[model samples]
Target: MQVEYQAPLQRLNTFGIAARARCLVRVRSEDDVRALLRQPGWDWQHTFILGGGSNIVLAGDVQRTVLKVEIPGRRLLREDERGWLVEAGAGERWHDFVVWTLQQGWPGLENLALIPGTVGAAPVQNIGAYGVELQDRFHSLDAIDLETGETFTLHHEHCAFGYRDSVFKHDRPGARGMGLRGRALITRVRFWLPRRWRPELSYQDLQRKVAETGIQQPSPWQVLEWVCAIRRAKLPDPAVLGNAGSFFKNPTVTAEQCADIIGRDPRVVHYPMPDGSVKLAAGWLIDACGWRGKTVGRAGVYEKQALVLVNRGGPQDPCSGGEVMTLARLIQTSVYERFGIRLEPEPVCVG
Candidate 1:
């Protein structure tokens, strides 16, 4: 385990928000975590587990001790006629892992290429893109209870996965729901990639790739290239521009609510789900509210994509977490007032 006090976190988070951690501890293995637990004066309860720092907004200097997960390993755990079970340590970059799987002839994770963050953080956010979600490929995960220092494994049904949500995002009450939020540190994640893989081209962007490229039966590598191209065109690389990929979750509304919104605006972008609900395009709403490329303080909306919030000041004078949230709130209020749909942010706000 590596430890640093008063650690500068401006470069840690994707937003490039200037902040600091009271103490930052990098755990490279399960043994590191266990060793930390044995140390005197260590307060595990108030510790914050950090993975890739890709999907977070640092509001201010964090008072809690930051535990940066850096464990690393990847292998084909098992394989058969059905599929292969792959495992990756928590610290492994999510996008790189996805690409590695495809290069090895594993195809299930192709749709999720180019996403930022680490393998450990994937299950926490239930990260999804195109027409695929983490839950779709997830087999199980291993995490350690911070409070008890006990390691445990949770399978698909135990995860309670939802749209950009999972058990890891919720706080556990007294013997109630299985909420691991802030209480467990994920160490490794396993995925089930089937032998008979099928491509997911239901999303409009992927469909457009099919039409433009004239590749009806796209290989996993082709799909990965296309997804990377699409994301690069729409979302700014975090290395270049400080911003999360999508600022808001696409709001889902009931059929009646959808009709009400459709009545208000004929050109509202929406998609019907299998469960009879309608998903509205959050970027479209923000664009309709005239927020695209707009700036407030040091934060601004990406000119190319309305769904992304960016740091206008860059790294030299990067935006504060407060400025980002202020701009986000203003955008949310405008969208709500205009469309009657409350937009939810995709990134977690931390301090």
Candidate 2:
């Protein structure tokens, strides 16, 4: 474990919010985490866990100790007639891992290409893209209990995955009567890629790719390329214009609410869920509210994709987390007032 005092965090987060951690500890392995926990007067309860820093908003200087997970490894754990079970350390970059799986001949994760953040953070957010959620490919995960420093494993059912949510995101018990939020530090994740794979082309972008390429039966690699291209075309690169991709979750509404919104604005982009609900396109809503390409203080909505909020200012005058949240709140309020649906922020806010 390596520890630093007053660590600069501007470069750590994709949003480019200037902030500092009172103490930042780089935990490279499970042993490192145990060593840190054994330190005298160490307060696990107050420590903030940081992954790839791509899915967070630093609202202010973090006063608590920051545990920057850096554990690393990836390997094939099992393979059978059913499929391949692959495991990856928490610190591995998510997009890299997805690409690696594809390179190794796994097919299920191709639809989620180009997503940001680390493997450990995927289950926490139940990260999804195109047409597949992490839960769809998740096998199991190993995590250290922050409170006891003991390791445990959880299968798919224990994760209680929901739309951009999981046990890791809640402190209170959910419908499943269990929540692991702030209590567990994920160390490794396993994915099961079935041998019997089919293209996930439910999303319009993938369908368009099919239309453009005239390839009805695209391979996993081809699908990955299409997803990456689509994402690059829509979302700005974090290195160029700092942003936490897809600032808001696509809000789901009841069928009645959908009908009401449709009555008001027929062009509203929506998709019917299997559960009889409707998922509204958050970007479309924001764009309709006239927020696309708009700036407030140092934060601005990305001109190309309204779902992304970018830091318009450079490093020296980057957008403060306050400015970002202010703009986000404004957008949320306008969206709710217009559509009678609340827009929920996707990133976790820390300080």
Candidate 3:
């Protein structure tokens, strides 16, 4: 375990919000995690597990010790007629891992290329894009119990993943409900890419790409190229613009409720889910309320996509965490008052 006192976190987080950790420890291995747990002053209960810092907004100088997971390794554990068992350290970059799988001729993860953050954080967010979610490829994962210092392995069933949510996102007790949030520190993740991988072009953007290119059967790498292109053209790169890809979760409503919404606003973009619930386009809802390109203090809604809240101020005068949340809350209030549905943020906010 590598330790640093009063670590500067401006560059650590993708949002570019300046913050500091009172103490930061980088665990390169599971043994390192155990070593960290044995430290005298470390407080496990308050320890914040930071991955790539892509999907977070640092509220201020964090009081708790930060466990910056830096474990790194990746390999094909095995392969068979069923599928290829792949494993990666928690600290491996999510996008890099996806590209690695494609290069290795493992086609299933191609649609998720170019996403930000580390592999360990993927399951916590159930990261999805172009109709493919982490749950679709996840085999299992290894995590350490911060409270007990005991290691455990959990399969997909134990994860209890929902739309951009998992057990890891919830705090036990209070809102307990099968939540393992703030408890397990994920160390590594394994994926099962099946032998018979198929393309997922059901999403509108991908379908449009297919239509424009006239490529009926695109290769996995070709699909990856398309996904990367789509993301680049849509979402702002964190390297240049400080923003988490999507700010709000797409709200799902019953068919009757959607029907009422459609009656009131015919142009409201919505999709009928297989479960009979209609998924409303959250960005469309925000845009309909005329919030696109609007700024609130240093924080503003992205001009291109209402779903993304960006730091309008550059590094010299970066937007604070408060500004981002304030803008988010204001947007949420407007959408709720007008549309009667709450918009949940995608990133984990911390101080």
Q: Which ten residues in a row have the lowest lDDT in candidate 3?
A: 171-180
Instruction: RMSD for all candidates, in order, please.
Output: 0.9, 1.5, 1.6
Better of 2 and 3 by TM-score: 2
lDDT of 1 by residue, 1-351 (tens): 899999999888998898999999999999999898888887777899898899999999999999999889999999999999999999999989998998888889999998999999999999999999999999999999887789999999999999999998888966656988988899999999999988899999999999998999999999999999999999998888899779899999999999998898989999999999999999999999999999999999999999999988867799999999999999999998998889999999998
- The lDDT of each candidate is 0.93, 0.93, 0.91
What is the descending TM-score order?
Answer: 1, 2, 3
Q: Model 2, 160: alpha-carbon shift in Å? A: 0.6
When 1 and 2 are scored with TM-score, the better candidate is 1
RMSD of 2: 1.5
lDDT of 1 at 299: 94
Report how far off residue 83 is in candidate 3 (Å). 2.0
lDDT by residue for model 3 (35-98), tens: 8778777567888989999899988999888989888999999999888999999999999999
Relative to the true structure, candidate 3 has a C-alpha RMSD (angstroms) of 1.6
